[model samples]
Target: QKEVEQDPGPLSVPEGAIVSLNCTYSNSAFQYFMWYRQYSRKGPELLMYTYSSGNKEDGRFTAQVDKSSKYISLFIRDSQPSDSATYLCATLPGGTSYGKLTFGQGTILTVHP
Candidate 1:
């Protein structure tokens, strides 16, 4: 089984709605987690990064991690069409991995007018 799994949501929402995305990882050693947003045909930009457990919130976005369940989530409030993009969840297993990130299948989101 893959170490990390995400729904790759082609999720659609009306403008001004909240958008939620999630991922699960199997490796308990993973100590770093991240979320990236990528527009079509472009490289992804880091949206959130967290070490170990807990939550991080920035503006309309929030990231959460639960080490016990090996799950991570990203929440976007008052989403806009400009938020249309692919979201990827990634993790670093630490140790000899040297911060190499293992990524999930990106979830595609479309915020409609």
Candidate 2:
């Protein structure tokens, strides 16, 4: 099984809706979790990161991690058309793979106006 798995959701929602994205991992050694947003034809930009397990929120975006369940989630509130993009979940194992991120299959989101 892949270390990280995410639904490559072509998730569609109307404007102003709350959007939720999730990922699950099989590795317990992962110490850091991150979320990246990529626009069409552009590279992904880091949106959030958390060491271990906890919740972090920025503006309309929120990230949550549960080490016990090996699950993580990202939530976007009051979504907008500008938020249409691919979201990826990533993790750092902090061993020989230092500085490298194992990424999930990206989830695509579209917010319609």
> TM-score of every model?
0.95, 0.95
lDDT (10s digit) by residue, model 1, range 1-113: 88999998689999999999999999998999999999999998999999889999999999999999999999999999999999999999766547578999989999999
Report the error of model 2 at residue 26, Å. 0.4
How big is the positional error of residue 20 in model 2, measured in Å on the Cα after superposition? 0.6
Point to the candidate with the largest lDDT: 2
Error of 2 at 86 (Å): 0.3
> Candidate 2's residue-wise lDDT over 28-113, tens digit each?
88989999999999999999999888999999999999999999999999999999999999999855445788999999999999
Candidate 2 colliding pairs: none
Model 1 residue 12 distance off true place after TM-score fit, in angstroms: 0.3
Pairs that collide, model 1: none
- Looking at model 2, residue 15 earns an lDDT score of 100
TM-score of 2: 0.95
